[model samples]
Target: MRKADLLDELRAEIGAMSDKYSSELEKLYQFVCNSLFDNMADYQWVSIYLVEDFSFCLKFERGQTELPPVIPFGEGFMSLAAARGSVVRERIWNRTEVYVPFYHGHHLVGVLVVTGTAGGNIDDEDISLFCELASLFESKVKKCNS
Candidate 1:
């Protein structure tokens, strides 16, 4: 499917899911991660890192391999994206990692991280779709937090 259509589908799914999984953000995160991985075959994995105190914990991940459960603040690509306060895309050896941070006011809520195979570097259109997904997730998070 084209990126635009896929995003529209995801937006609708997330909207319905926001109602169904309102109290369990982790389940919602897992669903989004799974949806992205299943819909976009090129991805190596999709995961969400939620901010807890001073660290980012692996909330939910959908992929072939297990990811680190905890990532310290100010470290790794997660930190880089958080510090930059925007989407950060980097080519890490054989993969392209995109980090999308979600914030509520000035407080960090979490991050949505998607990594795809090296050749699948995201262009402007792809990144825009991702940013939209992150925004959708962010709205849900904000509603729950409030």
Candidate 2:
């Protein structure tokens, strides 16, 4: 699917799915993960990790391979994403991975990770779109905590 169309459809699905989830925030996460997995083939997995005291914990995940349930704050490349305070994309041997940091104002709230690329490499436009999605998650995170 085209980027704009995919985002629009995902947003629409999230909007329509509010009743299915506990909140709009959860609907966003659920829809995005399922939608992306359905539409984007190259992406092998989608996962969201959020801060829990001094570490990041897995809030949601789907697709191949297994992810650690917890990662200490300021540790690993996930910390790099937190440190960057934005989207971070890097090639990991055979596959490229994208990491989107989620924030609640100045606080590091969470991160979204997608493994693999659209093709051989990820597009800058795609990263921009992912950041837009991350912004949506950020707002939801803020609202949930408030």
Assess every candidate by TM-score. 0.86, 0.81
Compose the digit string of candidate 2's lDDT tens values, residues 1-146. 68667667766675466435535676568677777777666778888888898998988777764458899987877899999787788877778788899888998878888887435445675677678778877766776778
Cand. 2 Cα-lDDT: 0.75
Clashes of each: 0, 0
Best by TM-score: 1
lDDT of each: 0.81, 0.75
- For model 1, how does the per-residue alpha-carbon lDDT over 69-94 read when each residue is reduced to its tens digit? 89899888889889988999887777
